[model samples]
Target: MRDATAEKTETALDAASLVTDMAKRARAAARVLASLNAEARTAALRAGAAAIRAAAPAILAANAIDMERGRSLGLTHALLDRLMLNEARIEGIAAGVEAVAGIADPVNTVAAEWERPNGLRIQQVRVPIGVIGIVYESRPNVTADAGALCVRSGNAVILRGGSEALNSSRAIHAAFVAGLASAGVPADAVQLVPVADRAAVGAMLTAQGLIDVIVPRGGKSLVARVQSDARVPVLAHLDGNNHVYVDGGADPEKALTIVRNAKLRRTGVCGAAETVLVDEAAKDQLAPLARMLLDAGCEVRGDAATQGVDPRVKPAAEADWDTEYLEPIVAMKLVHGVSDAIAHIERHGSHHTDAIVTEDAAAAEAFLSGVDSAIVALNASTQFADGGEFGFGAEIGIATGRLHARGPVGAEQLTTMKYLVRGTGQIRP
Candidate 1:
């Protein structure tokens, strides 16, 4: 019999070594990737898609190994579900590559330009962010998504996925490298941390000057830890406790439909609605809405007003207000009006995505303008908070931070602007 703790510790150490080595290689590869033309980059993305599709069987097999280990370790069904990658998921990764290929390359675009009085022309151009270190959880799909987006944007990527998904991540990384080779790009452009140790994350976070940026995509705990320990710039969200407000002027049919789909369509997604705010004037509608959620097998935690409306729901604790329960359970509340609803969101929201289902233009405008969130929706589901939905094709994750970027962090968001100045022979007098 093996000691699980020791096995986990050794595995983590191995991962740290792998990530540290890969980071060095990626830094060198970034210089080469930066010089490639748009056509060459697009070709690489297309090749990546083809490689992922061709390696679906191997990817699935690797996922199976990770899944088996995860279950034996008593991982939650949610985590296990995220770790398992099937043929369809493999195809989805391929589709992401294809989508990235179609989009205009963000690199080399002119962000802004200006002419100075002294015959000087200054132009701001977008450039790759260099080496991007991504640390994520059980979702194996992120391996392909982050790898492709970084490559397309001319940045070398180093991915460190969860210990439970190590095999799956490695298999995906292999396909990505093959894709890079098919396009004649350096295989080191996409690297996966070999060890699955938690310490690997610390190594990644502290790789300050070596790594340009560290983007952690996972639960709040992982992101928070990275934010605290990271020496480099971190682009992450503390939580995804999103919300949906059904205003009094809302179309009952539309509100009911959006709420149901938002909560039940897929509770595992970060943009899934965790709280439902109903207008006080429309409080009576709660009974029917609560039934819909319950019928869909969702567990409802309600405030006093919600508990009065739906006796089936349990009383919500104070902690529930600030929770990001990525499950089929939602916090239900009744608001006096739009202002009240906005206030509630401002206080408890994770600034991820918030939607308002209202027919009143004034109320809708107020909600959209007042809410300080990355994605604000009107007459739509909070689940629409996705890069694909925004027409960016695919995204590494949504950035809730105000600096650098916000919302769905696509390829364009991954770049920084540089000033290119052209001047005649003139000196300042």
Candidate 2:
């Protein structure tokens, strides 16, 4: 037994060493990626997509290994589901790469220009943010998404995916590197931290001086740890307890459709509707809407007033208002008007996405302007809160941070600006 334990320890040590080595190589490859032009970057992205398509069979085989392992380990059904990949998912990954190639490259653009009085001109130019470290869980698609975004934006990426998705990520990473090599870009432009050891996260969090930014794209516990412990700046939000408010003037039919789809389309996504709010004047319309949600197989958890209308609904505890169940469970409430809706959102929402269904232009405008979040919608399903849907191709994640970037963080949002000063011997006093 002691010998077996020691062997396990040695394996863990080897895995950690491999991860550190990969990080170093990625750091070096980033320098080469940072110098590529728009043409080279686009070519690389296109090649990457082709490579992914060619390797779809191998990728699926790798994903199958992950799925088998996850199932054998008795992981949650949701997690096991996330670990499985199919033909369409592989195609989706390739399409994501192609979409990114179509978007405008962000490097070397003059964002702003101004001339000083004393023969000095200044221009803010877009530039790469250097090495980016992304730590995420169970979605293999993130590997392709993060790699394509970073390369297109002229930044090198170090992706640390969940252990269950390791083989899948590695297969995808191999395709990306091959594309980079074929396109004359540095293959190291994208690297995966290759380890299952939990300590790998510690190494990434401490790579502050080397990695410019850290994007944690996973559950609340993962995001919280990154936010609290990382030496580098992190862009993350703990939850997406998104809401849909059906205002008084909202067309009841339209409102019901949107709300049902938002909550039931894909319950596991971050943007799935966790709460539904209705204006007091529309309180009478709640029964039909509740029936719609129920008919769609959603379990409604509602406050006292709402439960009175839908006795089948479970009584919602106070904490349900702010919970991100990430399931079929939805919390609902009734509000006085748009003001109350906004107030309720501000208090319980995760500041992710909120939709307002109303014909009143003034109320819609106020809600759009007043609600401070990454994405705000007018009479749309909150499930549309995705990078692909927004035409960004694929995103690192939706940023809730007020600084640098927000919303779907595509290639453009991945870059930062630097001032270029052209001066003719201008001297300061």
Candidate 3:
């Protein structure tokens, strides 16, 4: 019999070595990608989309194995949904890749140019971020989206997906590699970790020079861990503790439609509203909304005012205010008005996405300006907080940070700027 301790140690070493090799390959690939022409990058994306479409059957088959294992492990229904894949979803993934191909290339393009009085010409040009490491959970679609965006933006990527979706991610990654080959791009430009060991994630997080930036997309716990532990710089996709506020001046019909849709529309999405706040002046709107939620098979947790309006509502815990249910459960509360609603959101929101439904322009403006979340909406479902919805094709993730990237992170957001100076031998005396 093999020594279990020795076997585990060997496996750990293997995972670490795999990550190191992948990172080095990715760094070399990134240099090639950064020097490649934009048109070639777009071609690779288009080819990848076609490859994804062609390999749908194999991908779906691999997903079935993941689904079986996921069920055996008793994963939550929401997580299972995120892990599940069908032909339609495969088609969507392919279409998303193609959509990314349709976007204008940002790399090497001059965003700003000026001539100084010193006879020096300066230009700020967009460039690839080089190598990116993405550690995501559950959603296998991220494997395709993140890889495509990186390739489109002329960067190389190394992905470490959740163990539960390893098979699915591997299948998708194979398709991407095929596309890269077809387009004459470096095959290593889009690589995924072949192993399911958690150690791979650690290797990636600490890969500072090898990885230009790290993007984490998953539950708050996962992101918090990556943010706290990673030695490399990070682009965090924090919790989707989103909110929807119905102002006193909101149109009742619009409020009902947007609010219901925001929460009920594929509750697993990061944009789903976790909390709903109604202005006390519009207190009459609360009961109808609560009744609609209850009728739609959604659980409602409410504060005192909310409970008074609807006896069916369960008493809300204080923690519910900051929760990201990611299910058909929502918290309801009543605020004095827009200010009060804003205050509640500022205190409890995850700075991801927030929406306000109102016919009053002033109230809408106030909510829009006051709320500091990445994506803010007026009279629309928070579900619109998507990269594809933002017309950027597919997103790697929604970046909630206030730095180089925010909102839906697409190809343009993946690039950093560089300065090019042209001078006629004028020395700075």
Rank candidates, TM-score, best first: 3, 1, 2
**Candidate 1 C-alpha lDDT tens digits along 49-79:** 9998999989989988999899899987667
Q: For residue 21, what is the lDDT in candidate 1? A: 82
Residue pairs with backbone overlap in model 3: none
| Cα lDDT tens digits for candidate 3, 1-429 | 999999888877877788889989988888888887878888888899899999999999999999999999999999999999999999999999989989888889999999999999999999998899999999999999999899989999999999999999999999978987888888899998888888788888887777889999998889999999899999987799999999989899989999899999899989999999999889999999999999999999999988887788999999999899999999999999899989999999999999999989999999999999999999999999999989899898898989999999999999999999999999988
Winner on lDDT (1 vs 2): 1
Q: If the candidates were sorted by their lDDT against the true structure, best first, what order would they fall in?
A: 3, 1, 2
- Alpha carbon lDDT at 284, candidate 2: 79
Estimated TM-score for each candidate: 0.95, 0.94, 0.97
Best by lDDT: 3
Candidate 3, after superposition: displacement of residue 168 in Å? 0.9
Off by over 4 Å in 1: 1-20
Of candidates 3 and 1, the better by lDDT:
3
lDDT, candidate 3, at 53: 91
lDDT for position 83 in model 2: 70
